[model samples]
Each structure stands twice: as C-alpha cells, then as structure tokens.
Target: MGTQAPSDYSSSAPSKMDEQPEKQAKIDEKLQRQKEIDDWLPITSSRNAKWWYSAFHNVTAMVGAGVLSLPFAMSNLGWGPGIVILILSWVITLFTLWQMVEMHEIVPGKRFDRYHELGQHAFGEKLGLWIVVPQQLICEVGVDIVYMVTGGKSLQKVHKIVRKDEKDSIKLSYFIMIFASAHFVLAHLPNFNSISGVSLAAAVMSLSYSTIAWTASVHKGVQADVDYGYLAHSTSGTVFNFFSALGDVAFAYAGHNVVLEIQATIPSTPGNPSKKPMWRGVVMAYIVVALCYFPVALIGYYTFGNKVEDNILISLEKPEWLIIMANMFVVVHVIGSYQLYAMPVFDMIETVLVKKLNFRPTTTLRFISRNLYVAFTMFVGITFPFFGGLLGFFGGFAFSPTTYFLPCIMWLAIKKPRKFSLSWIVNWICITLGLMLMILSPIGGLRSIIIQAKNYKFYN
Candidate 1:
C-alpha cells in the first residue's frame, strides 16, 4: 500500500558523510606528523637561504680537489680529445644541471628536494627509490671517501712544503686522521644552511687555488723540451688511461649530485618560483666553474705537458710559499667539500635511523651516527688513498649517471618532447654519450687501481 509509506530512509542512505571528517582528521594527523619529521630532518629543516647562498654552495660543491687533477686528466687524454672532452663535459653538465633545477619544482606546489624524491616522481615510487637511492648513495658516499683522501693528500703536500728538511716519516694515513678530525667537529652542524659560511670560504679558496695553479704554471712556462705525447706507451695502456681521464673530467664536474638539495634550501614562492633564482645562482656558479676549470686544465697541461702528476700541485715544487698557500687552500676547500657531500649521506643515515629504525633524533644519536660515518670513510680513505684511480673509478661509475644521463632521462620522461624534436634529439645524444662514459671510464680506473695496488701496502 503506497510503497509501505514511502520508506523514510534518509538516515540510512549508506553515505559516508558522518565518517568523512573523522577519517580526514586521521589523514591530517598523519601528514602533520610527517611534516614534523621533515622539519626535523637535515634537508628540510631550513629554507631561509638566499640566491647567493646557492652560488657559493654550488661553487663549493663543484670546484673542489678535483680541479687540481684536471691537468693530469688532460695529460691522459692528450691535446685534441682532452680539450674537446673537457669543454663538452662542461656544456653537457651545465645543461643537465639546468634540467635538474627546472625539474625541482616541475610539479606545482611541490619540490623534489632530494635526488631520489625526483626519481620517485618520475619513476614509480618503489622503482624510483630503487633506481635513485643506491646510485645517489654511491655518488655521495664515494665523493666523501675521495675527498677524505684529497684532504689528506693536500695536507701532506702542505706539510712537505712547510717542513722542507724533515725526514717525511709521517704516513698519509696519519694526515687523513688529522683531516677527519675536522669533519668530526663539522659533521655536528645542523643543516645545509648552517654550513654556508664554511661553504663560502671553501668556494673562495677553490677559485684562489685554481687561479694560483694556472698562473703559477704560466709563470713557470712550458717544460724544457716539453712533450705533449700520451703518458702511456702501449695501446692498451693508452686506451685505459684515456678512459680513466674521462672519469677524472666527470669528477671535476661534480655538484650535479647535490643540485636539487641546494635548491631545496632556498625559499620558493608561487609567483617567483625557486627555479629562477636557482638558475641565476647556477649561472654564476658555472661561470666560476669555467674560470676555475679551463685555465687550470689547459695551462697546467700546457706547462707540464705529458709529464704532469695526477695532482698538478704535486708537480709544482718551485715557488715554495705559493705552493704551500695553494696546498693550504686545498685543505680548506676540501674541508667544506667533504662536509657538503657528507650532508646528504648523513641525511640518509639519520633518516633511516629516525624513521625506519625508530631511533630518537637526539644529539647523542647524531653524534654517534655522524662520527661513525666520518670514521668509516676515514678508514677507507686511509686503506686505499689511490687518488687518481678513485677519481676515475667513482667519477665514472656513479657520477656518469647522475651528472651525465639520468637527468636527461628524467627530463625526457617528464617533459615528453615530440619525437625527433630538438629536445628529444639532444636528450638522446646526452644519454648515449653518458652511457659510453659510464661503461668505459670505470674499466680504466679499475686497471689503474690494480697497477697501483700491486706494490701498495695497507694503510701506509
């Protein structure tokens, strides 16, 4: 009868309106907690940095001990290939760095502060983590280890200069320990922004030492009957040395590994996005990079020819005071470089501890974790301070992907330029070249390591 009085079912409609707010509250709570965690983390803890901070930070990041080795890298490659590759690397890396900065805030209202975060956005979440974390860790951790060796060797150079008549009894291992002690104190700094002063000083030191290196070479003039021939005689040796040289060049163009991390420090607004200022800062840094890299590589190579030591400073024995100053600058620059590279690894370690392992974010936790990390890298650096081999090895193996091709791949995936378009063609070209670098350079580096290791003793 009349559909059972039309069944008053409004209250029983099965709608979730009543439960929606409650569920939303839980979601909000979770998000808030995560934000709190991010705020406590090293990377996202501060966002007050200016554009100039980016400039010096990038300079500090890019121009480190690697610049001192550029001439040696050139010696390995010879004139034609060395100049071409050095210039090519500079252009390619700059383009990729631009891609990274553009992609940092590619998604509206979000920022991929870390390399892996952007990787996650481009690739699927799990796959992104798998792709980026291991590679990023390898690049970052590898740099720390290399810089440990760089800092130690630089300190040794300084000591040799200052104590000219000394017996040279102290081992490089001891110098590495002395260098690691600086990081033990420095690693306690809170975040990227906290270390800006150190980074600025390091950047200045980089430019200064680079200037001294090349100018000193100019002053010294070309070696008597200078030979521009390949350092190795055999074809196989030459090929491997060539490959290792690629790694050294690749290593010279660092800072790509930490570009996004540096960008994360600057405050971003919707109207004036972070990319603009980031790009400006990048341009400044690259100019500084060109100034520091080209002369050091070319002039140093020209002055020494094929006889250049793996570290150019090691080759220069004259003008003792200037060499000592350059060596001291290396020490200071690498001090900042080591910390810059280590910050990401520290972030990773602290993240896992606090979030994954449920450790409290206490000073004691930080003290222990950071100190242990410095100690671990110190141990490795001491064990094998094969600077040239390490430069080539880590440079090509890890750096090639992050610096050379990964950004291009990410750009292609995200931007999706039309087939055969300029963007498409360029990205592919970079990918191909980067692939070659990754495959070839590490082989040379490994061979060099083996040769060095044959007569090497542990921690000597």
Candidate 2:
C-alpha cells in the first residue's frame, strides 16, 4: 500500500508536542540557573541573604560580653561624658560603616568582599593588608579569647550557684576547654551564610541576657538606699581609669571590623544594588543596640556608682537563680558568637593555606586547621584569664584601627574627599581621634593589665 502523505495538522501536532518538552526543558534550565544564582553563598554572591538576616548577624557581632562593661565605662567617664562619648562612638562608627559601603561602588564591576580587600584597594596590597589584616585577626581572635574567658567564668558562676557546696569543684580552665570543644564543632561550618540560624539565635540570647541584666540593674537601683553620683569619684587620680573606661565603651561598639562583611549578606534588588537595605538594616540594628546599651550603662552605673565591677553582672547581688540563668544565657550567646567572629579568620587562613601554601581545601583539612585555631585561642584564654585587660588591649590596639583609624583612612583614600572640604575635615578629625585613642587607650590598657596581673593566676 502506498503511504499516505502526513496531514499538516498531524505533522504540526507532533512538532508542537516535541517543541513543548524542549521549551519546557529550556524553562527548567533557566530556572535551575536562577536557583543556583540565588542559592549561592553570600560571601561570593552579591545578593543572597535578606536584610533581616544581615541585621541579625550584625547584632550578633555587636552585642557581646562587652556590653556588660559599659556601666564600668560610664563610671569612668561619668554620665555626661559617658553618654556623649557613647553617642559619638555610635555616630562615627555608623558613618564609617556607610563610608565603607559607599566605597564598594567607587570602582565599577568590583566588590570589596572583606575589609582587608578595601584596605588593599585604597592602599597598595602589601601595606593595606599589613595594616588591616593583623589588626583584624587580633581583634577577632582576641574576642574569641574573651568569649572563652567570660563564658568559662559565667559557667563557673552558674555552677557555684547550682552546686553551692561544690563551688570550688572544677577549675575555670576546664570550663574554657569545654567551651572551646563546643566551638570547635560549630566553627567547622563553612561560612557566614551557613551560620544565619546560629547568628539569629545568638542575637536573641544577647537580647535575653541584656534584658535580664538591665532589669536587675533597675530593680537593684530602686531598692537601694545609696547616694547616686553621676560623675566619677575623683577626676585627677582616675585619669587612666577614665580612659580605660572609654576604651571599654569603644570596645563595646567595636564591631566595625565585620560591618562590611555583614553588609555583604544583604541581597541586592534587580537594577538597583545601592545600599539602601544595608543602611536601613544598620540603622535598625544600631537603634536596637543603643536601646540595649544605654539603659544598661545608665542604670548599672546609677545603681552601683563607683562600686560597679568591670562586669556589671559581677556586682549584682540578685537571686542566684536569675543570675545563674543570665550567665548561662551569656555562655550560650558567646558560644554562637565565637563561631560568628571566628569564621572570618577561618576564611582568611584557609584562603592563604589553600592558595599560597597549596594545602588542599578538603573538609578534613578545614576541620583540622579550624579546630587547631580554636585550640590556640583556648590556650590563650587558659594561660591568661584577665578578661578586663584583654578587652582593653583588644579594644585599644586592634579595634582602634579596625574600627576607627583604618576606616577613615580607607574612605579618605578611596573617596579622595577634597582637601579642607567638610568630608576631608570630618575624616581627619576621626583619624585624629582614632590616633589619640590608639595611642592612649593601649597605654591605659597595659597599665590595667599590669595591675591585674598582680592578682591574676593562670586558669584562676
């Protein structure tokens, strides 16, 4: 039988059916590409994280054990100077952070993923890296050490409360070791984006403990029958103490090192990648930070006056249950926060080890090196448990540059604000303040360390 010619309708129908799957496949492929782009790590991708996540990360970085010292800082500067300095620090830090975000756009088709990169962009690679990287490492590692010491102390406090008779049961070093081991596991998580859940939890824990501390302060203040003085006890003898307090306040607000990294997480919108979301998130986070910080500082100092301990919690004579719970929250928050801060250090070290030293970027290698780094920090914490002095040194030496000096310099270098113009003058003023703080605060901090060393024993 002769084959009948296929009808046009029949031919077209099969053709359309074939094309339907092909078209659908193309659509599926396109969707897959979009998903890859969207699901990519924020460290590498421009836009992956939502602004709220960024805010949570920022808060996690900003709110730490440092907040506990603000009252002691207030005691140093007194209420008037303390409040003024606190506001100024926040304003300057926020402005510098904005400058950092603004500089990201100055060079088209390039993004500054890390603070050191911005430093290298502004200055030569060697000089910029040297200026920023060491300070950043110091600040971050110092913070982790602080977390270890503070967390161990807090856990010890809780232990003493819960086990009253067993107050001297275990050494602080044991608690620090336990904390470090916990951090070792979490620190293995690949990057910042991977820790969003932990960051959010850390932020919540920060708020929880801070609220408890603040409430306790108010209650103590109201119930006490002591004279409240808004100023320091004596101005002349406590000059160094005053600066030490200033260093503490500066330290409390010294999350500027990670600001750009945190901002990197904010997802960019289509056709408009300006930093509106980042700015909004920053403003919101800082507002929450101020609310958390101010009341605690004011009320704690008001309650204890010159008698306030470096950590306000140390001074509180609250119910053992409440204090233990608050300290436990602190330990929990710091556990997550240690990972948050340490991740950047891990990225830096791993990049160098893999790229420069040719170490394979395998999971085992990462786990090993990262845990070793944690071990080193643990050793430091155990060897020197001077929490207050460490805070001072890190805040003054590391934070002064990472938080203040380098940002101004990078802004000046990248933006090249006109000579004697408002931007120039403002940045110069900031630079001057940074230099002054850098020079003086460290000296005071060193003095504090010397004084503290007299009574401090290893693993005490």
Candidate 3:
C-alpha cells in the first residue's frame, strides 16, 4: 500500500514551500504596519521644523553642564595637550557628525531617523540593534542622569547664593526631585517640534550660562597661586586623569548622538536634501560650541587651574546676582536638554510597550512611562552625583563609539571607500582614536568614581 501511491499532502495541507511564502507575507504586513506606527513616534511625528530648529536643538544637545567641566578637564590635561585634545575633538566630532547627517538619507527616499535604525541598516537588522541600542541608551540615559545632578546642583547654587544662611536648608535630593518634576509636565509635550520653544530657550540659556562661566572666570582673573599641574598626586592617577579628561572632551562633543534624529525633523527632498539645512544648523551649533568651549576651558583653567570645581559655576561664588542668574540659566538649559534626550528614549519605550509587549498606545501609558524614567534618573543622580567621573566613565565607554567612531564605521561599511583613499584613511584614523578613547578612558573614569564614591553618601 505504501508503494501504491504518493500521499496528496497538498490537498490535506499546504506544502512547506507554500507555507514559507505565506509566513513571509505575514511578516511583511506586520513590518509595514509597524512602520506606520513608527510615524506617530515623537522623533518622526512632526517633520515641520525649520533649519534653526536643528541649530538650537543641536546646541541644546551639545552644550550642557559638560562645558563647565572643560576648564577642570584642562587642569587635568595642562596647556598643550588640553588645547590639542579640545581642538581635535572639535574637528573630528564635527566630521563624524557630518557623516551622520549625510548618512541619514543614504538610501533613496528612506530616512534612518533613529540611531539604531541607521545601525540596523549598516550592520544588518539584528546585529545593528545589538550594536547601537546599548550604546545609544547609555549615552542618552547617561546624559539625563547627569542632567539631573546638574540641574539640582545648579539650583542649589542659586539657592546658596540667594539665601546664604539657608543654603543647606533644602537638600540636593529635593532639588533633583524638583528638577525631575518639570519633565513630568514637559515630557508630555508630544514630539520634537512641540518642544521647540523650550529647546530654543534652553539653547539661549546654554550660551548665556556658558558665557557667565568663562566671563566670570575672566573677571576673577587667574588665581593668585594657580598651579597648572595635574590634580592627582600619583603618576598612575595623572595618567588615569588624562584618560578621563579625554572622555570629558568626547562627552562635550556628544551632539552626534542625536544628529540623525535632529535631521529627521527637517523636511527632506531630492533637490532640497535635509542635509543642506541640517549642515547649516550643525555648523552654527559647532560655532557656538567653539565659543562656549574654548574660553571656558582655556580661561577657566588659567583662572582656577587644578582647584577649579567640576562645575565652574560652583567655583564662581562672588557676584551673587550673576552667579545666581547663571545657575538659574543652567537649570533652564538642563530642563530643555533633559527633555530633548528623553524624547528619543520615550519613543523607544513606547515602541516596545505598544509593539512588542502588546500594550495599547495611550496617553496614560506615556504619562506613566515618562514619569518612571524621570524618577529613575533622579534617583541615580541624587545617589551618585559624581559628575566628572560619570562623564568620563560614560563619555568614553558609551559616547566614544557613538559620537566619535561609530559613524565613521558605518560610513566605511556602507560607503565602502577605496583602500587608502582620503575617506577611508580618515574613517580608520577616527576608528583607531575612538577605540583608544573607549578602552583607556573608562578605566580612569571608573577609578575616579570609586575614589569619589568613598566620600559620597546616598541622597546627601
């Protein structure tokens, strides 16, 4: 009987070959739907921003509390190396950022809006996600956590100046809570364009306070006994400090993390590619970056030298009104920065909840998720407000790849420049530098954190 006839399996059930196509079609349909859902995300929802939006958004993203630390970083590096690192970082990071902008719309009529999406394109879907998401989340969330500490400290600085006797009356933990509270409201603003006003204000405030930081240092003049020597007493400590300082420089130029997202906001077309206006905005932002960084770094170190506080504002104690105002500006600027970074993470979380976890998309979900994120960052900030150490650690460990080398790698992979070509050589050089930064800097940063943690108490 077995030899008599072959079973008509196609009649009983579709053959495996047929099932394959059916499964593939279902997968394609699901992907198409998910793409539609992605459009509603905060990063992609509103694409009506002008070029200036990119300018301030990049400014708000790039210039943060990191600027205040530059002079301190300079103290770690000294005159020659500090100036060289800062300049190279400016040039190299700007190059990497430009590569990111150009890559945003590399494929025809398609935009890699999120950093991970671009990663997916370059490294294959699964590999790209693996490569980029951790780095990106680390960078974004790290910045948010740092901002929490920054905002709280800045607010406390204002309070200290305003109410000299009652400075310790309000706890820093409470101030951080207060800083996180604003995000609970502003996080609901629904997309990048919606928060443009806040970003604009933040951009202005970043410049304002940065001006105050360096100018105040200038007004104070160089310290009477300023020592341009390394802060750490030991050789190993100084080496580590140099590594950590490199991380600080890397962290300072970290606007690249959100460059693709910012570019996503600008409207793109064949003739009028988003890159043109995006580049214009980026150029302007970097100019602001140079203005903010160079003086604060050079003069701040010259003024206070190794004694300069991690936050320059903390060192500027006199001229009560100006210090108070600058600290307030930092508070406002951090408010904008926190939201700018958190927006991308919100999109990711909402995506996972709605798409992966089968949760319905609702305003309540947005509210709850955003609040939890703000709270988590606030807690971390209040617990370990080791600002410089955190920057150095996360800056090199996470930001180095994304900000410094990741873009170049993607460019080399996708563009496939000829060997020894200018593009090829440049990208390789960046990759080498970035890898060194990643490997060496975090060691220093972690050492610093451990040293700081020994003296730190939670919620103090």
Top-TM-score candidate index? 1
lDDT of 3: 0.90
Estimate the lDDT of model 1.
0.92
RMSD of each: 4.1, 9.4, 4.1
Could you tell me which residue pairs clash in candidate 3? Answer: none
For lDDT, candidate 1 versus 3, the one ahead is 1
Clash count for candidate 1 is 0
TM values, all candidates: 0.95, 0.87, 0.93
Q: Model 1 segments beyond 4 Å from truth?
A: 1-25, 166-168
Worst 10-residue lDDT window for candidate 3 reads: 3-12
- Candidate 3 TM-score versus the reference: 0.93
Ordered from best to worst lDDT, the candidate numbers read: 1, 3, 2
- How many clashes does each candidate structure show, in the order listed? 0, 0, 0
Tens-place lDDT digits, model 3, residues 72-148: 88988889999999998999999999999999999999999999999999999999999999999999999999999
- The collision pairs in model 1 are none
